[model samples]
Target: MVIETLPARLDPEEAKRVRQERLERIGSWLLPLLIMLFAIWLWDRICVWNEIPRYILPRPHVVAQTLYTDAALLFGSLLVTLKITFLSLLLAVIGGVGLAVLFTQSKWVEMSFFPFAIVLQVTPIVAIFPLINIYVDNQTAKLLLCSWIVAFFPILSNTTLGLNSVDRNLRDLFRLNGATRWQKLRHLRLPAAMPYFLGGLKIAGGLSLIGAVVAEFVAGSSGQSSGLASRIIEAGYRLNAPRLFAALILISLTGILIFLVLSLVSHLLLRRWHESALKQER
Candidate 1:
């Protein structure tokens, strides 16, 4: 006997609806971008009228000139800052995820270590920077530690919440399937936790950048292996307001880029099957 298989069918009207929706979304973004550009222009005009001194608040054009003239230096230092942020984030994810798993596995461990994680989160990194620098002996390592401390708590707390927030029914189902604790964790909890994990990652990305900048400020590491934070400090000290603003702009742009990249990654990972990511799109 021969068997026949049919191709899936799609409604033309549904396809057209989706296309229109996408176009509407694009238009929404375009309008906001245009508005932002107009606002920048208006701000520039006001600054020009006020005759703001370059030493105080430089003209946007002057800041742009400084940025373009020192593009190479700025870009190179940006890479250093990016590297430290990325590395610290990687370490934070590993440490946080591992600890979260441990906490979920043992109530005693959760009770013991969770408070310390809270402490780490609440304690100002500025206050600890001196201690960390003294103990680490390496300036670079000290900066990384400071960044890691800033980034780690979110991942730990969020992941722990995600891991434990699994539905009781699901847990029972897994147990009914003769699933071991490890199997349940691998198959059920981890997938359930991805949304929370990504949320924490987004927050952690920004925090990592802040931590790196703050640590550099505290450590006064502005010579070799220094990042954009040091450049901003140097510019400020030299009374070059335009250069300082340019550096600040670069840092802000870098942060936005990091956030956008991570958001894209999260969308790619979760858009297919996850309700939280795909609900609006659907």
Candidate 2:
């Protein structure tokens, strides 16, 4: 019997090259990242050298230290913000998709409600938050309602466009196959609408965060339970510049993480099927 050895794995040199390529990709991003860090550092240094009061501007290191010291409080506030955002987003997706389906089935309904959707999109959340607060009576409920209003439109618009925008040939084929409306929706429209839905989801994620912050800004001052916006407001009122800065940093990081997570989800869902995702390797 002939003994056949398996092919050797990547050699050290090849592995090193692969590592270098990854580092190079990361390195390409380094300059801009460093520039941002240096700018922050320089700003802090300048503020300190100018004898700027802590209330005016705190050092970056001081802000970072403050964050470390108050990690529990900061984290709790962050969790509250995240809860409102995600719950609102869940409601938006369900309601939006349901409305989209209704609109797709009824031209009259589409004509009646489409303009209202556009109106909602254009209206500032700040303008309506107080009304929602009054009607809802609970700060968290008002916040959720505001966030849902902000987030639902994108999903509705995108999914409706997708469902109704299917190719005529595909529709004809489905009809020829004796497919019911629901079957056509499930098999043909939904798969076709996934990209659009994902696009809307990305937009809605950011909008949800914005809605939460805006709602908190408008109505949370009197509430017992509050989100990160309250922490930011409290820090500012107390003239605790470092704490304020830390809260701001946390908010920024939260937004970035949401975007990153949504991006990854979009990639995972689309990579195998969508041309836009597959074009990367090409």
Give TM per candidate: 0.88, 0.89
Model 2, span 142-213: residue lDDT tens: 889998999999999999998888989999999999999899989999889888988998899888988888
Tell me the spans in candidate 1 whose CA falls farther than 4 Å from its real position: 1-27, 221-225
lDDT of 1 by residue, 1-282 (tens): 222543365489777886898999899999999998898798788788998778997877888999999899888889988888999999999999999999999999999989999998999999987788668877678889999999999999999999999999999999899998899889999999998999899999999999888888887753565688888888888998887888899999989998999999999999888776765533
In model 2, what is the error at residue 243, expressed in angstroms? 1.0
Q: List ranges where model 2 is wrong by over 4 Å.
A: 1-24
- Judged by whole-model lDDT over C-alpha atoms, candidate 1 comes out at 0.88
RMSD versus native structure for model 1: 4.9
Candidate 1's error at 134, in angstroms?
1.4
RMSD to the native, candidate 2? Answer: 4.8
